[model samples]
Target: MACLSRHRHHHHHHHHHRAWLTSPDPDMLHHRPLSAHHRPLPHDDALPPLLRTPHPPRLRHGRHRPHPRPQFDGPDPIWDAVRQEAKREVVQFNSLCASVASIAFLVFHFNCVQAEKEPILSSFLYASILAHDCLEQALVFVLANRLQNPTLLATQLLDIFSNVVLHHKPIQRSIRLDVQAFKDRDPACLSYCSALLYMKGFHALQVYRIAHALWHQGRKVLALALQSRVSEVFGVDIHPAAKIGEGILLDHGTGVVIGETAIVGNRVSLLHGVTLGGTGKEIGDRHPKVGEGALIGASATILGNITIGEGAMIAAGSLVLKDVPPHSIAAGIPAKVICGLQEHDPSLTMKHDATKDFFTHVATNFRDEMPNG
Candidate 1:
């Protein structure tokens, strides 16, 4: 995975490298007509025309004459050529146009591969650059009509979703961290791109992000509609009202349910079939509040307003009702604190049957390897 720092560095380098293009040197001007001396104006012709001021301020007869400039009565070939070149450069650099061109290249590559021809690395590289938002765009397209507006175009849908979720800086940062969480925590996740594109858990979480934002903005109807689409598509039901922190992994997301008023903390891992629901008939704030770095195992049902403390680990198939202390392991029906974990964050380690301390295990292995002394 490429770090954001590296991307910023590259972007900075690109701007610095092209710094000269923004300010032309007076000794190399060639695009326009020569001055009063009939000698070419001092300017750098190598500078791209887009950055070069179209009408450069020139000194004529020792006076700054703004008008009576080199007038092209007809289409001057030199000016026309510069204008065409600038248009081509602008189109090439436009991100949206690049993305569209990338899609075409990807389709061509797919066809070539299907025909048993060799895949092109150059094509794949080009596609990867512009297709970073492909998954997000696809998600928007999938839920475009969820609001029941049949006349909305795909581009409009993209803009709507981008404004609500994708374009927000905080949401974008959360998504990158979410993808990193999937890559680091899930053994099956091959790469950052794989997590971004293929993981339904990731997809479900991102949709919830969009819904969560809309919900706060008082678009309750649209938020609920998105919630419905998420449940139908991903089998993971998280209420728009639920509060979830970043770096969360809803592993094997099928059948995972997080109810309204539920609070899941940062770096928490919830396995498949886990439920954070209410104890029943209570009106306000009934769902469980899971702490940061907590690991809830498969089929674990945590109910009420109980706190699964930070770094707590709940064993698989457990029924948790009471509050579980931090760094403790809870298990069995109506789960109890069976033991404590030496590992600081069980969510990071994902060790289910860790009875002894992690260091104890390491020391035991070391002892076994040593000769009798």
Candidate 2:
């Protein structure tokens, strides 16, 4: 009975800590309540020099602090490194979970189409599909070198993460802001971020990071092997040799083609069924070169050694055979410049929306020009 009474007295000694750091001036001094929970925040004189000096968490009564700065002496930097690495691992594990889930959902949906019960598969699929994009986005940040930028990285990362709770904003706004934040942090990120944004659903660079590791360590073949796996898995069909840029949007990207020696510029948009192809008998950089901010609309085929100039627009269903001028709107069987539209301007505002007759006339004229192949 005496020991139980003594334990209660001991508990009461630290019970005062709960309301300890409730100070109004957070900007000047971060006053945390004195408790085991507050341990993560520093206490007194033992703070890092960056956090040194007594910016004390004063009481509500405006009196000097009663406790010496809580001697913050125990957070092991080494352990902190371990914790950070663990955090990255958890993020990666979450990514794998997302990938697994997406694949499982696809499988379950496929099975549902057949009216079959894929029991074990269905369970895992439902769980995995839910987290698929979460992981993909997290993976996107992990590989972007965004974390290395320190300033912009934190801001952009927070924005990317905050998107989950930030209801009612267009996904593109979040994407664009994150990309801009990343670019402001580092210019080199322009290319990588562009490519990653367009190819957000694809983990191309994550695979490339692994491949790069192998290539530098004299594992050329092994790296290329992983590169092939990335292509097979992602299905966007980027060549290991092709150089791509940042802020790209590969919309509904299946059956999208990118050829060897192709150089893609920043902020390019390639929609579903778009082909950057070559003449069958040709080889060596003979494929189309996509320019920056250029939108290769759905089913737009740019064949042979054609350069679609910067900010150009290839209308949906257009097939290009010649070099397109910058900012020109090209369309139809043998594509022609019907008008000019800025790439940044969305399609609803395009003059072409008001000019379907012009495209029909051009299509009619061009069809007659084609050799009956």
- Best-matching candidate per lDDT: 1
Give the runs in model 2 whose Cα sits over 4 Å from its true position.
1-201, 204-220, 342-373
Off by over 4 Å in 1: 1-129, 132-157, 355-373
TM-scores for all candidates: the values are 0.60, 0.44
Model 2, span 169-190: residue lDDT tens: 2222223322332333323333
RMSD to the hidden true structure, all candidates:
17.7, 18.8
At residue 224, candidate 2 shows an lDDT of 68
TM-score of 1: 0.60
Task: Determine the C-alpha RMSD for candidate 1 after optimal superposition of all C-alphas.
Answer: 17.7
Q: What tens-digit string does per-residue lDDT give for candidate 1 at 1-373?
A: 1111101111111111111112222211223443343322123233333222232122222332222212112222222222222223333443333332322211012233332342233223222222122233334433442322444443344445756654554554456557667877899875554554468888788888888998999999978877887788689899999999887888989999999999999889999999999988988999999998899999999999999999999878789999999989987677889787788878877777663454355568989999998
Worst 10 residues of 2 by lDDT: 1-10
